[model samples]
Target: MSTSWRDRFEKNFISPEKKLGLDEILEEAHDAYLGWLAASLTAFHSDFNEDQVDQLDRIFQGESRIRSIANDCYNYAINGRFRLAKDAQEQEQMNDDWVCLAILVQSARPGIEEFSLTVRGRPIGVPAKLEQLLFHAQIRALLDFSTVDGFDEESVSVPQFFSQPVPGYLTLKEIALLGQMSERAVRNAAQPAAADRLQTRKEQTQTVVDATEALRWLKGRRGFIATRAD
Candidate 1:
């Protein structure tokens, strides 16, 4: 049997007499996607406890809604309804949402990376635990960077969201290179933001940037990101 949203999508293509605009078509497709997602989660719920099932439902549903909204943003970007900066902002938001979706789904996925065994049936090892923590931190970092919500799923050019680098640890030399400054200048800039985030070793004598902490700093202090000429 065809679903309500599925019927709508099918109608959009099959009902030649009916005329719907691009925006309407996008909404119909997005709603169908949500319906598919809800059905998938309902199936997955049988394997999880109440708490985990709730969380899984929330994570999937959350992105499903965001995808609908961001699809509009994507349309605006392509249609030139807004400025270049607006396009960039939409691109960045899409990127953020994509990252969040990956982290959330993988963190909740049943199987370990190395094997097909579900977390429900087996004890999570050190690697799995670390992966979960890293996902949480990435989510927090995304929140710290943008007050606006994030989104993704549709394919597009320009921003290349999937290809963008996930923020990673920055060595002193790397930070300096990214900032287009001397190593001394990088150290000076780090000093102010280094209060609680300083990750150092007595043996190494060099502070390292954990990926999440590094993202927070890079997002705000994007001195190295050269802007296109207006």
Candidate 2:
């Protein structure tokens, strides 16, 4: 009878004496978790928009609450604290949780759209694709924030262009190019009339100096010094 029981046990379980080491199990889990994270982030990135990306960048720049929520979800997924194993359901839940947290973090911003919008400016509600894109953008932003050194914590001020009531907007490519230009050169390139208008507006209204203005101001000062008599 004992021999028969032994045989049955061996048949039912291939490894009666051998067991998976904790480190080995954890390593496997880590690899799987990382894989899932990468795939999900990739899917999200494929459809992200500029606005959503900006929001995520802010969150990554050390928003304490956002960090906490994301860390909680990550810990739960990696440690298998909320599930028996990292299966499909677990992976989906982790992804969903991350998206939810990102939304919450972004919603905290002032003047943020209510995760809902229509192409025609009507209230059609937020689509799943948009939501996913926003979520992914936030992730990217956070990652960028983490890698960036010496980011300013204070809110940035913007300037109006062309004497218009509305603020000016620039394309990403334009902005990148502008960043490479010397401050003096940028200001020097601005039309004298436009520069005068900008100065007048600056004196009249309380506006935060933007990157462009900073560069222009620096250039102006340098030119003034160079032309001055010794």
Candidate 3:
């Protein structure tokens, strides 16, 4: 087996044709990480209602840890940190790097270290519910989210669309982020001067769009997936 993290990751995690420049790769990785988190919630909390899962999904976006992890892991592999795994221990360490990234990204809170199954650096008799949830979710994320053979049925796949709940009203920034477009683009589209302009209303100093109008405008655009609230 190849010991190099970069080589192993390239061979296992992504399809050859899907590889791109660093920036593009990182962008896709970030999107994929968030998508996975959102999609995986149901598996982690099967008994939880849709509202519960939606609430948890919102919590996942509270911190940008997943984006940070994607960048850090990409940089680690690209910056010559990946070494040839010559022995069992070395190979395990290489695997841990990926696992660590998965674990950290699963944190709903700002500081992942706070989720450590410990207090003041000391182990506890029983881990807290949140701690256990994050721990197991990370393991499942690595195993199921990866393109590795045996672990996943699909050898190659694209990031699937994950729906986020939309509020009755959204700021231009929120619309841009939710729609996977730029704020500039959203602003331009919302401008009165634009043809087929998106309808908007002002809230204090900020401009906001009605969710129904936003979706109507967005639905006509290429690659725009509709989001709903229950």
Reference-based lDDT, residue 77, model 3: 28
Q: Which numbered prediction scores highest in TM-score against the true structure?
A: 3
How far residue 52's Cα lies from its native spot in candidate 3, in Å, is 34
lDDT of 2 by residue, 1-230 (tens): 12342244324422211322334333333322222223333355644343554454465543443344444433332221222223445545545555555444323221123222222122332122222222222222222222223211121210000011113222221222223333344344444655432221242343323334433443343221111101
lDDT of each: 0.38, 0.31, 0.41
Weakest 10 consecutive residues, lDDT, candidate 2? 155-164
Which residue pairs show collisions in model 1? none
Number of the predicted model whose lDDT against the real structure is largest: 3
Cα lDDT for residue 84, model 3? Answer: 33
What TM-score against the true fold does each predicted structure earn? 0.25, 0.18, 0.32
How should the candidates be ordered by lDDT, best one leading? 3, 1, 2
lDDT of 3 at 46: 36
Q: Candidate 2 regions off by >4 Å?
A: 1-66, 71-86, 111-230
For candidate 3, give the lDDT of residue 145: 27
For model 3, how does the per-residue alpha-carbon lDDT over 58-149 read when each residue is reduced to its tens digit? 77652255445445444322221212344456545545544545443333222222322222233322112222222222222232222222
Of 1 and 3, the candidate ranking higher by lDDT: 3
Order the candidates by TM-score, highest first. Answer: 3, 1, 2
- State the weakest 10-residue window (summed lDDT) of model 3: 155-164
